[model samples]
Target: MTGATTLFTGRITRRSMSGLIIAVLLVTPLEAFAYDNPIVTGTVPLRAGLLLLILLGLRTTRITAVEAGQLFLAQALLSMATWSVLLDFDPNRIAVQTLAYGTILPVCTLLIAPKATRRRWAFLVFCVTLYPAVVRLTPENLGLLAQVIATLLVHGASVAALDTHADRAELAGEMADIDPLTGLLNRRAALNELARGVDRSADDQRSAAIVLLDLDHFKQLNDTLGHEAGDDTLRHVAHVLAAFVRPTDHVCRWGGEEFLVVLPDADEALAIDMAERLRLRLVDVGVTASFGVAEVEAADTVTSWVRRADDAMYVAKHEGRNTVHVARRTDRLTVERPGALGAP
Candidate 1:
């Protein structure tokens, strides 16, 4: 729904900007004739043709919104400069142009710098829009001074409004991806990330693995200790998993008391070793978790890959809990218990 709304809004914005440009093109010739300025009249054909070409390019080419806005803004600024020169820098006309761009340019700057460089670009645009009015400022035309103040206020307001909106949108997206209880990636977000990781692993011919951990006796803990203690245990387990994993790894609450940890660039051996370490760490926190480790295979889908790890986890639970089991590519199982030979 959000994607559809964004697409619809983009179409509307494109059409509106196109319509505005065409309207300006249609009006330029009328203004040239009405003013009867020799230079304006003489250059009408050339200027109109240039604008029409730009509009045509906007329609025929694939360009981002920022690029399109920039083309239109460049044309508008050029036309304003041309008219001012043709009219001998008429103070009234310059003031009008300054006011018009003071509004238009800042909006375009919003499109141009939607991210980190927004303030820098806005500052530059505000100075550029203010240049003409500054040169025309005098005691007699102190209204130009008023125009400067208005431009500054408008520019500042635009930046503040956009920053607030962007921040909220970002926060909302993060919240959507997070688990409410554990503050880890929820099942849905984890699956999406796993899919991407699988694709990357296939493309790069690198190894990737998933460790599925299930807290032992979690239901009994909830029933006996009450739900609050269960929730605390879940949060504590999530923190330990997060702290134990490498920076490239992903820790997710895979529903209920099950957690999935994605390990990129790791083989079966590494996966089992990591799982063993995680089991020991959970024990340190006075919690015991059954772990299953499965390295990704060439023909494995995300579902099948996670299923293999999950199957291995159950094997650990069956082997008297608090142990790690590895899923080999051939679907063979190696039950690894703590203190076993070749075990960490």
Candidate 2:
């Protein structure tokens, strides 16, 4: 799924944020003019009010976590400034402040993260669920009715622009996460995929596994033959790894001389056996690597499990290399255990 990810729309949220800051900076004169001239109260304030509404809309429609994260940061800055400037901020005077500030901390959380966690998405879900109640509670004659209506319309426009941007950003991100050399998934892309898989498994009641591979004596090959030959060796090994992975599964270059395989629906025993086969297949492919296998437990997360798998691979390296070691679970999983080749 992460073979290609879009970077960011750079449209709705970024543009909106910029426009808001600009309008807010430029509107002091308007605010003063409106304050002095009673006749121009309705008309003169329109531009500033319209700009604020548009900004709100832009903030509302972001789809990516990074965008969400940046938005939250922007809100925090805006919120603090607004609070400090106002002599007595009240619902009547700054009614939407409640919505503006309340949404900031959580939505800011969403934007800071590259991927949305269950809790973060829950916040969005809450907003979605509570929208009907929001409409019901605020009637047409409510405080700042005109401003709220304008804000809603702006929100709609921003959302439309946001969807367009998200589609592109996801694609850009995926592209960035690819290993340019061998067309394999890069570490970032793989991590994202594995995390997503764990989420899916949790939601659907399934299983998954992660295998780590390290090419034994790979440094020797580079030292003796040349870096070019070593690269060719790695590429060839990548070809073997690609063949072993299921269409649904994925393989990634987990940095120098290391590869990670994400296997969905494979348990500990089965994953260990699969690792043995993968280890042997490298021999057939004319390159060899020490193998370490780790399974995703009911309680495991992508980060913890990957670290465990990496630890197991190191154990395999320590035990004379060229073997497979399955990560054992203790109170704390330490891949520092003695390595041994086992049943395939």
Candidate 3:
């Protein structure tokens, strides 16, 4: 495996082990919870063990933002389940734990540097879970609720702050390659994505499609609605395009309000059809886009392929604001450029 892959694996495994430890050392002890009346005299260990395994499973896999959200939600749910097992049927414990856990999610996401896997989200949730159970002396710790909540929030807020810092740190290196307002991949990212698409197509022997889209009368929208609104409009359009794209496909905010869509395994005809679909789809959003699409030639260079698509997009703009044009390049590796090499 590559060094990067090995590093990712190491990180994931480390997190998984930590989660296992938490389940064993901390949560398990809580099973003999109520001093005289054990929360789950026999089943406590079993529940903790199950949670450990599940946490391990999640930490071992690749993570995504959506999964992160679900993990936090799941952790809050699990905390409630754990509370049910406690001998004390204190609604406050259940309410405080569940509500606090829920409230802490966005804060957790904002604070924590994402784990290399989906498990990080779970970790944050687990943290919130452990807090109320540990902090609240008993169900009726009413007077202490404010203090406890304050401490937890402080901790959670700290995590959110840390996460924000980490996200900014990660963004620093790639900031030059992403659109500032919309956070879409920029021109540089598009170039890198183009090379990646071609490599995948060559390896898999599949067709790759490229589409260049430019918003119609985008300036007018800015003029009419204001730049802030224009920015929101741009973000909305990005969400739409992102929804349309497959995970295997690449979509970049090419420049300004223009976008580059790369569809791997799609031929010229297929590329054009998808481009047309984009054109029509934009109407629903009260904005229009023009598209220029191309298929990866046998040995096409980035310049050659992109120039054709770029030209086609203008052609579409000339014919009509919302339309598609198709083009094809016959050569690859025809230009000298940075990061253009086809081999490692």
Model-by-model lDDT, in order? 0.76, 0.62, 0.63
What's model 2's overall lDDT?
Answer: 0.62
The TM-score of predicted model 2 comes to 0.49
Better of 1 and 3 by TM-score: 1
Q: Per-residue lDDT for 100-146 in model 3, tens only?
A: 55455544343333446424654555555555554444546654555
Number of the top TM-score candidate: 1
Residue 103 displacement in candidate 1 (angstroms): 15
lDDT of 2 at 106: 39
Compared with the true structure, what per-residue lDDT tens digits does model 1 show for residues 63-121? 54455666777766676666754576566766766777776666666555645565567
Model 2 clashing-pair count: 20
- lDDT, model 1, position 298: 87
Off by over 4 Å in 3: 1-176, 201-205, 328-344
> In model 3, how large is the Cα lDDT of residue 292?
79
- The parts of candidate 2 lying over 4 Å away from their true place are 1-171, 331-344
Clash pairs for candidate 3: 111-159, 111-160, 111-163, 207-265, 207-266, 299-331, 299-332, 300-331, 300-332
Model 2 lDDT per residue over 70-136, tens place: 5434444443344424334343434453344334333333334334352445255334433432443
Error of 3 at 136 (Å): 42
